[model samples]
Target chain A: MSDAEDVMIVLDESECWVLLRSHSLGRLAASAAGVIDIFPLNYYADGSTILMRTTPGTKLVEMTIHSDVAFEIDDFTDEEAVSVVVKGTAEWLDTRSAIEEADRAPLVSWLPTLKYVYVRITPTSVTGRRFVRGPEPERD
Target chain B: MSDAEDVMIVLDESECWVLLRSHSLGRLAASAAGVIDIFPLNYYADGSTILMRTTPGTKLVEMTIHSDVAFEIDDFTDEEAVSVVVKGTAEWLDTRSAIEEADRAPLVSWLPTLKYVYVRITPTSVTGRRFVRGPEPERD
Candidate 1:
């Protein structure tokens, strides 16, 4: 429930992580050169890190050049909406051990593609907000 | 229906615009300094631009510094998934006439907040992809 004044509530760190674990679909945004590119990704949140699979494509190449990226996920209903944003560093899981560990998670590309490259995002900060869905307050 | 080989198909320009208009919830990503930030927002797509309202905050401030931004929206069902990404420049609507015209849209803040500032994104390029949800292809 929301207070009368503030319809948006800031979620704690634990709450943010809980929301992250509950959803598998999200968007990853990374910048290269001067242009920013975002892609829809299906990820697995393991502990405090995010794991995803990508084929050798623009997403992997851009993140290699610029590790700093933003990942976001949101869920909405008729009564309330919640969103979580993660600012993190994305690194490819190159080691054999890392790849084996990532394989344990149920992470798979939504499309039937050959995605052997595993990428992990170590979050620098996680922020979330929950909004109570309702009509806007009247202007004075 | 998807072909037996390729599970993902690239959408054309007109197809992208139609998907953009079908949804109002999306994520906006903007970079300032060196870090990129993504925010979940509800927006109205008009003609060839996207219009959204926000209060004086980080989203507005960062866009003012670097107008270049990326916006993404996605939808998924049990059988298929679709995502659209727009790379564009964002500018705040300052003139009264511009604000008045935006007020006609069915755009409203999800929460009860004063969002008088309207920002519009004029896309330099739009890209979209549709994926048929299925299991990963077997390794050879």
Candidate 2:
């Protein structure tokens, strides 16, 4: 078990992006009708943008109305955890070429539903933190 | 590997609350200043409400301003996944009795920070879904 004195370290932009690219599962948060909704999704990191697919639902409608959204991914062990958050604007990839390229990416919905509409999030800010568990220091 | 013909079933409110009680880790989403943010948190299910603790930061500040937030908890295996979402309003537990009772709750911040403020979310709605993966049927 990890001690209770571990500290959380802030990750830089490059490191944050690296972590984002390394993970495939994330949660997408958007607001509609003054209510916030979050959905778990599988995504692909394409350059500086994040790509995901969704069918017609609250998430798609909310993103279309309010492009500003947040996506988060995290992995944890018993001792430590790393979390990355991306804040950006979401837009649907309506072009044929864009959809074709996104189809080739590794992103796929875990559910067996048809996720034809592709949404891209162009990140405005990317931040991350790594929580490191270690031995507690003795007081002098 | 499971086939690609799995189905997603919408769970009832009772089932959703059951899943929420089963999991302690979740992501909390809040919005402020036209930006949405998500934080990984350890929470406790208190009746129909959700309880968590945190130090002063963007999460706390945003929740105080907007109050409207989304909380999500999900569990997955190689073949299937279950997700639950809670949409609610957040408020700090300021009363002496409230603080004392909350202190005894199971909610604890994983990080080694002083999370003295206890926040409670009275859920407005609770929804859940279960993705069941299985063999695909033969095509005619």
Reference-based TM-score of each model: 0.93, 0.87
| DockQ of each candidate, alpha-carbon based | 0.61, 0.41
Clashing pairs in 2: none
lDDT of 1 by residue, A1-140 (tens): 33334778899989999999999999888887767878889899976998888776655555644379999999999899999998888898888999888888988578766545778999999999998888766644
lDDT of 2 by residue, A3-76 (tens): 33347788899998888888888999897556678999878997699998776554555554437888999988
Model 2 per-residue lDDT at A129: 89
Docking class of 2: acceptable
Stretches of model 1 off by over 4 angstroms after superposition: A1-5, A64-66, B1-5, B64-66
Q: Please, what are the lDDT tens digits per residue for candidate 1 over residues B1-140?
A: 33334788889989999999989899998887777888888899885999988775655555643379889999999899999999898988888999889988888568666545778999999999998898767754
Model 1, A41: alpha-carbon shift in Å?
0.1
Give the true-structure RMSD of model 2: 3.9
